[model samples]
Target chain A: MDSMMMGAMSKDMMSMPGMEMMDMSIMQACMDACSACEQACTVCSTQMMSCAPACMNCADMCNTMMRAMMRMQGMTPAAMMAMLDACIAMCQVAMDECMEHADHSEVCKMCAQACQACMDACMSMKNTMMSMS
Target chain B: MDSMMMGAMSKDMMSMPGMEMMDMSIMQACMDACSACEQACTVCSTQMMSCAPACMNCADMCNTMMRAMMRMQGMTPAAMMAMLDACIAMCQVAMDECMEHADHSEVCKMCAQACQACMDACMSMKNTMMSMS
Candidate 1:
């Protein structure tokens, strides 16, 4: 997200219930990770491996997770938590699937790394929310 | 999806554990709905209303739901069910938000309609899964 949009989004989040303690830096990192993971997975999904489906699924999940963070005004805390969990689960599944082909495909390796990063970011967001609450 | 890609995806879905009973026509309609909903929401989000956030969130969810259907091989029945439920919830929220200003904005009216159509399609998919199972 651009600085101006992020500023606007941050302003919006302040009025949402249970989002007062959100760290913009943490959310920014997570959104960046999600964007990268989505890009990598979209590329990997064209590889025609059995992992392609998992890659496609993860790309969608990461995009959704990222957008949800940007649109916090539409979500409650519980809804955000559920979305983060779903994104984490998707990243885990995609990473495991991509790793199976990492030895043969460089794209798979990169995709797996992206998924791992996204998973970590989502976990951080979840933990941050828990601590703040 | 183009017919060529759809044909290939259909072939793949046949091998997934619980997707054999899927009706491709229903899947295609749902995909079309999702695609339309996503596009409409994307446009509607730029209107700077309180509904913008919900529209953004719905756009992401619809895109994810569409991709998940195209990549059924990545999903277990339980996971697919959960995703369908999430998509439905997102659509409901978005449609309600959009409808709030439907009388004033033509874009909101179209967006709400798209959301409603997407919800109906997703519900049909869920019902199909239940009946087949």
Candidate 2:
């Protein structure tokens, strides 16, 4: 996310209970990772491999996760945790599937990496929230 | 999305284990509902209410669910079931949140209705798959 958007979001988030204390930098990293994973998965899905469905699923989950962070007004910590868990699970599945073809398909290799990064980012966000509570 | 795309997907799905036996019309309805729900949720998110985050999350999940159905090559009945459950859960959350303001906010009312329709369509698709299995 851009600094301007982050500034806007930060202002809007002031009304949410715990959100005002959130580290925008960490949230921004998570969103960036989600966006990257979504793009990578979208490309990988077009490969027509057995992993395609999983990639597509991961892409959707990542996009949702990113958007949820952007719209903090609608989030409860519980719901946010659940969503992060789901995103991480989906990313793991996609990464596992993509890894099988990583040797031959560059797209799969990149996608697997993206999934790994996204999973890590989501976990980081989860940990941050856990500590906050 | 379109007849041409559906035709292409139908042809590509022929090799998937159980998908060949699936009903395209029901799948189409589910996809359409997801697409509509995603759009409605996206618009609703801009309202900046407490429901905005839920709406954003629902939009992403619905889009993901729709794409998963499209990429049958990547889905096992198990994964599909799990995804449907997640999407349904997210939609329910979004709907419940939106319903709180339905009396005054037309956008929330419409988003809630879209979430309900999407949930129904997804359930129908699940039932159809279960019967086939």
- The digit string of per-residue lDDT tens for model 2 on B1-133 reads 8989888888878667787788888999999999999999999989988888788888888888888788666666766776777777788889999999999999999999999999999899889889989
lDDT of 1 by residue, B1-133 (tens): 6888888888888777777888888888899999999999999999998799889998888888888887777765655666777777888888888999999999999999999999899899888888888
- Encode model 1's per-residue lDDT on A1-133: one tens digit a residue: 6778888879888777788879988999999999999999999999999888888898888889897887778765665776787788788888989999999999999999999999999999999998988
Rate residue B90 of model 2 by lDDT: 82
Q: Which window of 10 residues has the lowest lDDT sum in candidate 2 chain B?
A: B71-80
DockQ score for candidate 1: 0.40
| Best-fitting candidate, scored by DockQ | 1
In model 1 chain B, the worst 10-residue window by lDDT is B75-84
Clashes of each: 0, 1
Model 2 iRMS: 2.5
Which regions of candidate 1 fall more than 4 Å away from where they truly are? Answer: A1-12, A127-133, B1-12, B130-133
In order, the Cα lDDT scores of the candidates are 0.86, 0.86
